[model samples]
Target: MTSTGTLSRAQGTALCVGAVLGTGVISMPALAADVAGPASLLAWLALIVLSAPLAGTFAALGARYPDGGGVSTYVRLAFGARAAAAVGWCFFFAVPLGAPAAAAFAGGYVADILGGGHTTMVGTFLVILGLVVTMNWFGLRISGRAQLWLTGTLAALLVVTVVAALPHARPANLTPFAPYGWAGVGAAAAVLVWGFAGWEAVSSLSGEYRDPRRDVPRATAAAVLVVGVLYLAVAAASVLVLGPALGDSPAPLADLLAAGVGGPVRVVTAVVAVLLTIGAVNAYLAGASRLGAALARDGALPARPVRTPRRSLMVVTAGSLVSVTLPISLHTSMLLVTGCFTLVYVLGTAAALKLLPPGWARRGAALAFVATLGLLVLNGRPALLSLVVAAAAVAYASRSTSPKIRIPSSSSAGSIAPKPNTNPVESLP
Candidate 1:
């Protein structure tokens, strides 16, 4: 069989790291701190444990069928065409909306660093998005190097925050830990999942990896472990030092550092936050653009301009706009998009279970999928709505009539004309 696409192992890992370590790290603690202080560390631990196996499944899928479509390609192989299309659409929506939100967030942080103003905020947002879009359009190779630098910088900042604040941690801040109770923990876990959601996206690039079957899983597990620890350290430190104040501050990390290192630290922290968000936006732009291109190739989307670099730039730009304009708090948006992504994960996990024979591993995957879905529901109305929208899109894509290419049973890589069928949905595998 001929390979249709490819990505290096470093690129794959960068994609995962970029997806996980975004502005959410700076924002999530504040939103969930009121409900679960250091206890939220438990949530991060759970995500790390859960994401590994799910990531392994994606790696396996990618190794076996290294198509450009990523998760949608796996779904097509296991379920059918319509199902794959729906999954693709869900991912497309989530990524684009997420891009703009991240850009806006970075802009907001940049404004803070520059003494703050609406004009600066909007201007920064547009400039950052434009820069990222240009880089992606030009097929930039700096993403991997950028990811390494950004990850190191952010990790150092968290470590410093943790060490500086350790002595100041208040026991009382951790008391009444579950103020919102188990339900609140569950709700926050839903949002927290977003911070750890991109591991599978890495697997989607297996075709590009030097040795996907081995490297993808290793990178995914390692990245999750590293990022998970970083998150826990930051969360614990923020809760210990900031205590009740954690819930009120938008830039909790900066606040913690400024308290320990003086006012100058705020400027440094703000700069890092802006860089963090920009890195995330760039990564998402690459991912979402690739995903859109894959879907268009499959005829799941309209036969529009998807292949050209300019078209891809337009698509990423438009998505960034939506991310900026979406209602609901950033925390809420993270939860909602994450819930939609969780549904994508459920479908993928179920596909893995179905395509693979009955075994202990499959059973474990099924359990994790079910548990994650339960947590997703706990994210409340907005998350539920996102899930509902995803479902509807899947159903429509499955039933709609569209031109499709058929892969022949032979190992050769030629496409065949679409044949009329009683069933409207097209099957890829």
Candidate 2:
């Protein structure tokens, strides 16, 4: 486990959970509640249920082709280098866009509590970015350990908050459920994408696991359970206890904790929100760093003049700083983040269906493909920009070629090639 790329199942599970649950838990319930009232629970439940097929498809692929390249590896095996590069671009670019949304979310909560408005939010965004970039500079083993610690602390606090708030739940809160009707459920589900979009992330580090085939699936299953319970408990508590007030609660978890135990707990929850954002951002930075290095090694990206990992981290950090300054609310910015990940999921599932063995694996992959496609469509106009970006990547990749670098395929029946000589410039988390 102390080896550079060797992660235990527990550490792998922590990474997946940390990647999935970010600052969204702090505000998603309110955002969904505003869109669909108490019925937002349906969106939460639907995504959790859908996560099985989505997560399973990616885990199966990761187990089959354990590579630093991750989803891009699968896409290469299935569709060739051009499609792989496109999927890789979607994923690599997503971290910068998504990081600002997550950091801004936690920063907004801090602003609400401490009264600094745009100044506080922007400053918090930069600080979170700096901390994550610095943490990742030490490399993946350190970052994975940090993720394990953060996930444990954050999960414990959430469970405690949910348990304390349960006593305040009332039957009347369930009566007016669906006040905005069924269409709103679809709208709410689109927003919940930010919360559900992380299972693919840890797969990029599949090569880091001591036993990829054995540990990767187990870790994914464990993460699904942990994240599902935490999300459902918080959403149910927000709706049933906070009721109509749920929509306007900027710090929903804080309000829930205060109502349950009273006093200063909101500040504690706000602190936890910042830590959760750090964990989430750290996980993405870990994966994206490895991914950028891999892509560069395979000629999908240009060779950087500097070390790939550091350069990628700096680029992402700089982009996030620019993005954080945009005149958009956190909720709208998050929906855009959702669009980016949904496109990644769509490409990943398509690769799964193409490359997985026939029978239940293919069937499951097909189910994931169809479901993600539906969600992409539901994601509406914001998603068009992501789609356009993906098309551009495909066009860009079609014009270029890299030689002799082959990823293992399921067609070869799980006999993997010797691990690629990942440049010393690359590392996994």
Per-residue C-alpha lDDT of model 1 across residues 75-103, encoded as one tens digit per residue: 77677778888777777778776665565
What lDDT tens digits, residue by residue, belong to model 2 across residues 174-252? 7677888999999999999988888777777887777778888899989989999999999999898899998987788
Off by over 4 Å in 1: 1-7, 308-310, 326-328, 357-364, 395-429
Judge candidate 1 at residue 15 and give its lDDT: 64
Q: List per-prediction Cα lDDT, in the order shown.
A: 0.66, 0.80
TM-score of each candidate?
0.85, 0.94
Off by over 4 Å in 2: 1-4, 305-307, 409-429
Q: Please give the distance, in angstroms, between residue 364's alpha carbon in candidate 2 and its true position after superposition.
A: 2.1
Best by lDDT: 2
Error of 1 at 416 (Å): 15
